[model samples]
Target: MPELIFRQPDGSTQLVSAENGSSVMQAAIRANVRGIEAECGGACACATCHVYIAPSDLLLIPAAKEEEEDMLDGVCAERREGSRLACQITVTDALGDMIIDIPDRQY
Candidate 1:
């Protein structure tokens, strides 16, 4: 299992554990992490599961594909350099510990 550190909009943090090969969105949902709404489940259709990757850990995963990029454009929060949809990130040992930043709102 890998650990994910989610930094909430209020500057608070929630730690969620992830199973290898499972998506980050799944871990957050299972752990009941407040910021990952995942309204579209893991289908990559909705940007409700948007999360900002810590720059330091950005290299651990591949960049967003075209479909995910399209959805991200509609996120209610401002999109930044490290923006990503949690549903697209699969937990792996190489990711070790991921620090994600949750935007202020998903709706």
Candidate 2:
């Protein structure tokens, strides 16, 4: 199992094992991490699962798709270079031990 490190808004971190092939948002929800709402249920329509990929881990992730990029415009936090929809990020061995920073708000 891959380790998923979730960084909370107050700077606290929670480490959880990610199920194989699950999205980051799903894993967070399963763990009841509290920050990711995933209102669209992994659908790209909502940016409720917005998160920021740690700067150190950015290159490992694929570039954001157009739809996701567009939806990000609605996120509560201003978009940054590392911004991404947690639902679009799948857990993989390469992404094991990944670190994701939750934004201040989910809407």
Candidate 3:
């Protein structure tokens, strides 16, 4: 299992093990991680699972697809260089111990 570190808005951190082939949003939901609402259940239909990837980790994952990019535009928080939808990020061994920051808002 690969672990992911989630940084919440309140400055707390959570480390959760995510199985390979699952999305970050799924792992967050399964682990009851605060700040990751995941309202659409990893369907990519909503932007509530928005997170910010660290610059170092950004190079490890694929760029957001067009649909995901479109959804990001509507994110409640300010879109940033590393902004991404957690539902679009697949967990793999190569992404070991990656850190993701939950935006201040997910509405």
What is the C-alpha local distance difference test score of candidate 2?
0.88
Encode model 1's per-residue lDDT on 21-54: one tens digit a residue: 9998998999999978998889999899999997
Residue-level lDDT of model 2, residues 29-96, one tens digit each, is 98998789998899988899999997779777788899998999888887898999999988888888
lDDT over C-alpha atoms for residue 23 of model 3 = 96
Residue 60 of model 1 has an lDDT of 91
**Model 3, stretches more than 4 Å misplaced?**
none
Question: Which candidate do you rate higher for lDDT, 2 or 3?
Answer: 3
Cα-based lDDT for every prediction:
0.89, 0.88, 0.92
- Candidate 3: pairs in clash: none
Candidate 3 residue 60 C-alpha distance from true site, Å: 0.5
User: Which residue pairs in candidate 2 have backbone atoms (N, alpha carbon, C) closer than 3 angstroms, thus clashing?
Assistant: none
Error of 2 at 36 (Å): 0.3
Every model's TM-score: 0.95, 0.94, 0.96
Q: Residue 66 error for model 3, in Å?
A: 0.2
Ten residues in a row with the worst lDDT in model 3? 35-44
lDDT of 1: 0.89
Q: Give the TM-score of candidate 2.
A: 0.94
Give a tens-digit lDDT track for model 3, residues 1-107: 99999998788899999999999999999999988888888888889999999887899999999999999999999899999999999999987789899899887
